[model samples]
Target: MSETETCDLFVIGGGINGAGIARDAAGRGLKVVLCEKGDLAEGTSSRSGKLVHGGLRYLEYYEFRLVREALIEREVLLKSAPHIIWPMRFVLPHSPSDRPAWLVRLGLFLYDHLGGRRKLPGTRTLNLLRDPEGTPILDQYTRGFEYSDCWVDDARLVALNAVGAAEKGATVLTRSPAVSARRENGLWTITTRNSITGETRSFRAKCIANCAGPWVSDIINRVAGSNSSRNVRLVKGSHIIVPKFWAGSNAYLVQNTDKRVIFINPYEGDKALIGTTDIPWEGRAEDVAAEEKEIDYLLAAVNRYFKEKLRRSDVITSFSGVRPLFDDGKGNPSAVTRDYVFDLDETGGAPLLNVFGGKITTFRELAERGMQRLAHVFPNMGGNWTEHATLPGGEIPNADYESFANTLRDAYPWASRKLVHHYGRLYGARTKDVIGAAKSLADLGRHFGGNLYEAEVRYLVAREWALEANDILYRRTKHYLHLTDAEREAFADWFAGERLAA
Candidate 1:
């Protein structure tokens, strides 16, 4: 028999929403327990296009409210996690065959003004023939519009939120699935099973928040034995990674023949991230992967605008994720509203808050508003604070990452430029904790290919709930992309043996 722990909130799922809510709730003086069936952000969160934007395309659907809220959140998120989120300019080549020039200008105008737009710049017209951003663009694309949005390391964002929650006294359980939850004696009883340890734990919670992304419906019906009037519409979006072909730091947004848009963003240092197609998905979310048709479609879209042609062989890797959109009866998956909807079921004196349809940009706001909905249940919990609070590793003074990086370089002059960048970009203020008392490269411990050292691995295991190599390789860092296949296998073997010995 396992011991039962009591908490004020039991949050299911470890994606951005759940982690954000747990962080927000714990900071508000509420006891929080967050459980994930797999590693944090293993689902939709990690597989996103990885942008903290205002959903500029949503303007076409007249989703002004959602876009405005997300737009405002862009700056807030950038301030909170400056280490992981930074400003990026997007270049939209004018396609006379698609949207009219006047409509594009009008949309860009609303996008510029709808949000507060403080740190980021406004939209500017571009001469594709003259501007450097247009060098890779086809000659036919003579005119373009450049606008601002922030890029994010989506998995790290989720991990940092979980770390923030734990720091605020929240319990985070990864690889632990909520097997069953029920309302008993005016409180919800939830049980979780650890997939690795085969240990079971019970928790009595006053409220349950289902932020299960694609599994929201499953948690409501199968796990909690409850139902919601709202249903999640699963839409598949896929992205491809290839060698960076375009010059400059700006991203490209091109229109497809089908009236949809595709983003070609600069990724990692020398790679480009291109995506995504909106297709109604019927298969299980876990089984989602990029198909050949989607790949060809994305290639076609990019080839249509750029002078440099990309073939299937150019793609290094591809990934697909399901969007748990709130069904609005829209026939086209592209037209489905990106807005979120919440369903609160308060029967039998216990409440189950099911979250449906939310984007990464609006996650913090979603968590804050979700807490507001439970204000009556937790009358004494503190008011909203995440809006102004800094996330883990975002403690750079005044949110200036460049200045902090320079200071870090001066402090660790012994470290190479690449090594310093790896630590500064990922750990920020916590870089010292990772480096510890190490004075030299040898002091950092065994080298595991690239800039990944034993020091960083030890730090992640101790603080960030990193239990496996993939957690560090794919999610915590993009070391896998840099390391050779043989090196990755060797590192995985070493990690497994170390964990076993422990």
Candidate 2:
């Protein structure tokens, strides 16, 4: 490589934490460079529970600090990206066989008041037989409690952070992996190879941040050749998507006999997203997939409370992510801490910060604190500004999405309700840019299937760094759920042809 380019900071892993850190650091006027082995959020960040929630169950683990910080972040993230993150109410039906009702109530009480509760409503007891929110539950359950959290577009959250970082003058290299790094003469020299173009590049950075999520240690040991006492426990989490079974928009949190809670949330307007089983994983992080037993476990948990029984055949799609948890010597995989830990190795004058264990709910705070760890290196960098700033296209007035959706309807009454909703919910204030001069649906060009319009695909490709068909189908949008196999094949073929032509 011809003399490595120098930067103030170099970040590995383009997941949420890395992206958030890059955005914050770049906005401080620092020369930043961020690289990811795969696409942005191609790791555990995109394959999450998709909730900006303060892991309610973490209360059992006595993670008061983590829960409180995440709770406070709920509203902050909502304000920052209202189009992608919104409030969600979870109905926890009381099961006498599990924890006592008072215990559940106490947990909810602490959860409601533990953080600065604003915008979202407090928890409320519900009569399962009478309350509309409890209609989906079986008659055996007589009481319930509804508490608030926020839902997030996990993939988009990472993308927005990267976009914000890029706009703030950060060099973000997707599909590029940090091959190696070494500290020399008070600066860290890092080499990266583009996975697509096979181009090798090097940079000299004053500081290095490893936010590789599941690959934190891989980056630390294999790439940076550094050591840290802090270790990561890889706990595999899996989720399954199925057709909507419940009547209301509210989500259900049914406790299993084993004390694990399963979330059945409304997803993509018509479908339902159910997930997450925690099991210790030993396989490669890239090869982790939802096993048959996991799918069964999820179905059994949901079947215990819901009136409608879900079976193996009900599963439409499934995904799995390995949580790079900070190993606190906890025996149970679920008992491990979801909170992040930073290891700053300033052994050779140049500093290396390695992060392990973090959730989507606490990414911003993690980034802020990560920066504070390196404050001595960049003493003159700008002050913290992310907490009060809106993400790209999230400049919706007062962060009110409903009002903006209404405005979109008035402007494009000719557009179908679903199409209007798709744009408003995804783009927010930037929906106009996606819809450009054309007033009618015809101007959107070809329609592949569902809401997969040609204009949106082009925009994702040219602007959002969408390279492959799955990037658009599954991550950028959940059009895979609506499109038939033939339709998907056609879209993929068209996308490949367009790329080849370009």
Candidate 3:
């Protein structure tokens, strides 16, 4: 028989929302068990457009409340995780054929003032022909607007939240699926089976939070045998990665003929990430992939604004994710609400909180509110505290990453600047913990190409719940993007050997 544990909260997902909720609940003195069937953020959470901004276009749909909350949360998130989230300037080259200049200006104005703007710079008008940001843009776009937002390593954000939850006395079970959940004796009995180790564990939880994202409905019906009146509308969004053609550090936001806006952002060290088409999807989330037409559509959108045209051959890679939006009877997938909905099913005294329709930008706020909804059920849980708290590795003094980067370089003067910068951005104050007492590059152990070393890999496996090579290469870090084909294969082979030996 598998060992059974008692917990105050049982969260049935490991995506951003579920991880965030687990962290918040644990911080409030609740014993939480967060279970995931795969690596953290291996699904939709890692495949975001990588921005922590108030959805600028959501304003066009008159979603003022949603926009305002996201804007406010943007500031809070930036303050919380400056290491992985920082201010980014987006240049929107005005195309009179798409949206009028006045309308764009109006939206920018509201975006600046909608939430209490702090730390981040406000919007500004620009002469596209004169500004450095306009150099790569076509001459036809004479005027433009530059606005502020923040970029995030989406996968790392989810991991840090899970780490925070664990630090606060929460059990984070990765690759463990909740196979059975039933309401019994005013409590919930949840059983989880480890897919990798063939180990089974059960928990007696007072409440359950169904933050299963796209699988939210499935968990309610299949696992818990509980039904929800709410449903998720799966919207597929795709992105393509290409070699960075532009010279500036800034990102671009352009309008397509279909009235949808596409973002072309500077990604990694030398890549540009262009994305996202909102198409209604009736397929499984795991089966989502970027179609050929979607790639061409993104390239065509970019060609419309830039002087240098992109070819389909220039696309290095493409990925797709399903946005589990709440069904609001809206026919247009783009018009679906980015806001979240919570259905608290308090049947038979054991409550089930089902979350639906939330974006990465508003996850913290969503988690905070979801916990507040169960305040009566947990009459003694702590009050809201994540609002101003720093995430793991984000404890830099004053949340200043650049200053911390310089300080880190000084600390490890023997390390290359690129290595220092990589660790600084990814791990921040925790870089020392990853590197240990290593004095030089040679002391860092086997180098599997790029800045990846044995030290960091060991730390991730030991502390960050990294299990397989994909979890380390794809989700926890982006080492696969920089490593060559042969190098990646060799690393994977070596990782398998190491796991078997362990």
The parts of candidate 1 lying over 4 Å away from their true place are: none
Count clashes in each candidate, considering only residues at least 3 apart in sequence or on different chains: 0, 0, 0
Question: Worst 10-residue stretch by lDDT in candidate 2?
Answer: 432-441
TM-score of each: 0.99, 0.98, 0.99
- TM-score of predicted model 3? 0.99
> Mind giving the per-residue lDDT tens digits that candidate 1 earns over 1-502?
3989999999999999999999999999999999999999999999999999999889999999999999999999999999999999999999999999999999999999999799999999999999898999999889999999999999999999999999999999999999999999889999999999999999999999999999999999999999888999999999999999977888989899999999999998889999998999999999999999999999999999888899999999999999999999999999999888889999888989999999999999999999999998899999999999999999989999999999999999999998998898888898999999999999999999999899999999999999999999999999988899999999999999999999
lDDT scores in order: 0.95, 0.91, 0.95
Q: Please list the residue runs of candidate 3 whose C-alpha ends up more than 4 Å from where it truly belongs after superposition.
A: none
On the 0 to 100 scale, the lDDT of residue 226 in model 2 is 86
**lDDT tens digits, residue span 1-502, model 2:** 6566989999998999999999999999999999998898888988999999988999998999999999999889999999998999899999999999999999999999988888999999999999898787899999999999989999988988998999999999988899999888988989999887799998999999989988888888888888888888999999999999988778988899888888999999888999889999888999999999999999999999988899999999999999889999999887888988899999879899999888999999999999999999999999999999999879999999989889989999988999999988888888888888877779999999898899999888877788889988888777888999999999999999999898
Worst 10 residues of 1 by lDDT: 421-430
Candidate 2 segments exceeding 4 Å error: 1-3
